[model samples]
Target: MTTRTDLLVVGAGPYAYAAAAYARDRGIDTHVVGIPMAFWRDQMPADMYLRSGPDWHLDANGEHTFEAFFEDRGLDPGEHDPISIGVFLDHTEWFAQRKGLAPDPRLVVDLTRPNGTFVATMADGDAIEADRVVAAPGVGYFAQRPDWHDQLPAARCTHTSDLVSFDDLAGARVAVIGGRQSAYEWAALLCDHGAERVDVVHRHDVPEFAKVSWTFVDEYVDQTLAHRGWWRHLPAEERAAIGRRFWEVGRLTLEHWLVPRLTPGVVHRHPGCAVTEAGSEGASIGLALTDGTGLEVDHVVLACGYRPDLARVPYLAGVLDRVAVTDGFPDLTEGFETTLDGLYVIGFAATRDFGPFYGFTKGCPSAARIVVDEMLR
Candidate 1:
């Protein structure tokens, strides 16, 4: 069977909720799909805290904020410096409810433009024809499992994105790979979950977490909106370097919060080292490191994070061949619209073009405003 809407929002996270709410309020018939906050609720550690501050929220018209959510729930949000994961999930659900957003709890298996309009085929064979589509599958689509990872036993090494819960891993020693937020965050969580030991292995000799101002984040979004031609003219490497610099501050600064749980005895971090080789060690995972030392662990977790490669988006497989790309990311216009008319990418997929803001909750309102303005145009 087939249905129709003016807009199809493919993911139900912060980006999709904000986009659909704004579009719908503007009188656009918007249909949202995918489970709400699926990534945070399912994949992230149960007790993980948000790396961002209280201002980060999924408000469509900027009327609702995490502060507002907390106020309504009879709590002073200011009391909690960094919100807990569970509290963030509650806030997201409350925001969705307030926006009247009930995303179709099914996956869009395939999307194609066989005719003039776009058709989204659902997992259950239902179809939705739309004049426009907003794709925001979040970071899960862009997870980076390195090629060298295959050297380790599949059961031994797992991507951080795939980790649902550490309940069963109690008392098991684990090694978390990477130097950034995910690696450090997971190492702390594993420790909290009663893991016997958690070792962080990274290639950098000294992990740096230079301070970056929040004003810089706002500047990125504002500058992109003000002068996109100049923004796009910048080389991809230069843009990535700036974004990486901004991103480093968040991850590294956030790591300080985990230090209480990650101490000298509870957690050990090995810097300037890379896993050169790996195999099964009797009944455990064995790793040969670049430091010329061997280590054994019950399991290994790769917190390498995601790359903005469009190839990682599964539902877009049917349509990817036609869109123009800039350095493996979707090439977007000033309005966040893809090469295809009436179609847009708002989340991580739009980061490279829209700047660093689009990848975080704080950028949702700006991103939604840009896309809605374009769709109205």
Candidate 2:
């Protein structure tokens, strides 16, 4: 079946919801397609808490702030200093329903450019056309597969993003690579779930990330605020390069908080080491490091990070090719528009154009304001 609308907002994450809400407020007939809260619901572990503090609740509309959601539900946000994933999900579900922007939970299978509109095909054989298309489908699910992992059999190696259950790692000695929040959370979760030992390997002497402070979020430190016009004049490649720098510069590693809570000897840290080879030995996996070290583990979890692969976002692939892309990520303009006329990207994908904070909960409101203004005008 084919339906049509003024704007088709793909993805149902914080970014997607924000865009849809803004558009709806302006009386734009916007249709949001994709699984609602898929990342927070599926990828993130239930036990994990948000890295940001309570004040950083998801608030696209000021009235629908995280605190407000909890308050409406007879809960108190102040009671939870660090909100759990479950609470965040509850807030998102409530917000989505309240705003009447809850998406029909389904994967967008393909997107193709028609004569003057975009033809979006869904997994269930539904189709829609829109005057403008917003590609906000969160991050693609594929984790960055490390080079060392190619030698290992598929079953023995898996990215942390792929795991839905810890039952497979029972009594296993697992090694997780990277020093970001995901890596630390995966290590903690594995140890909590009965893994024999979980080794967190990092290339740095210690896991470190930029300090998180509300002051840094202000205009002076976050260059995006100072140079909002920079993206429009620069070439796409240059813009993306600048965006990546901002993203890396703003993130705070989980080691800052998780290190103190680690159980003695359950989670080991291997600093200044890198995985160089991975192979399977019967039920175990053999991993070799660049530092002339080797370990035999039952499983390997790669938390290395994510790559913005256009292949997973089939709808934007052709449109993406027309625009400039750096390292497989879309190159967007200051307004988040691609080279394609009616196509725009938001959230992490728009970081290059919007700056480093584009993917965070805080950035959603500003991005929504920008996109809604552009679409309406």
Candidate 3:
């Protein structure tokens, strides 16, 4: 049987939930599909902490914000400064219930538009037809693999996304690549899991652990909603300046809370370095660094982060040609619609056109409002 909906949301993360809630509230008959918060539950470490605070949430109307969740549950916001993944997931469930949004929990195996209507094939062979489709894919599909990924035996290599639990690595020596927050956080988690030794190698200087403010992103998100093509219309230098500001706060600064978890001698930091060469060496992987250093580890974790590529999305393979892409990101309109009519892409993939804030939960409410309003128009 074919399920029909006016608006089909192809994910159940923060972006999908918000968009669906908003669309339904506007009488769009929205139907959502995907495991709710699957990426956060499976890809992230079991005991991981989020860099974002309780203020970030997925309520498009802003009536049931995370702050509201805290108040309703009588949980003090200060007690959860750096929120845990578990708590955030609970809040998402509460928000969904309050909005009467229950995702189908089925994966969209394939997506294509035929005869002026969108058809989505579910993993269980069900088909859903809709007038419009809003896909809010998470970042797991876009994980960036380094050049040396294939050099070593596959058993000794893993991406951070797939290495959520470190129990198996308790007695192993591991090497983590990338200088970003994930790299450092994973290192700390590995230490907590009893990894004998962890070597963190990166091409950039080690980032400082300090508290930083994200209030600066509010203005940009507001501008994105108030003015069409706001981010793309900015002057070249202005865009560059904004990018720099984000890099400084989001990348150059890590949460001071991670400092204690990264034990001194157990987790070594090799900054200003790159893996020039890597190969299997009997029981371990041998790595040659750009700084003329060498290391041997039982396993390697690639925390190089994600770069959105529409073609890499498995479900979009059938209709990918219909979508225009810049670099790897979709060429979206100011309202987050892709080149394909009535189709929208949100979350991390929308960052290129909407600005970096769209890649975080902070942009959820605004993005939901913008996309739904555009759909109505």
Best by TM-score: 3
Model 3 scores a C-alpha lDDT of 0.91
**Which is the winner by lDDT between candidate 1 and candidate 2?**
1
For candidate 1, write residues 56-121 as lDDT tens digits: 777656687887888799987666756788888888899888888888998999999888799999
lDDT, candidate 2, 53-168, per-residue tens: 54554444577877777678887666775678888888888878878886977777778886878888888898888999888866644368777788887777878777757877
TM-scores for all candidates: the values are: 0.93, 0.89, 0.98
Pick by TM-score: 1 or 2, better one: 1
lDDT of 3 at 51: 90
Model number with the top lDDT: 3
lDDT against the true structure, each candidate: 0.81, 0.74, 0.91
Between which residue pairs do clashes occur in model 1?
none
Q: Model 3 misses residue 298 by how many Å? A: 0.6
Q: Where's the lowest-lDDT run of ten residues in candidate 1?
A: 205-214
Question: What range of 10 consecutive residues in model 2 has the weakest lDDT sum?
Answer: 217-226
Worst 10 residues of 3 by lDDT: 53-62
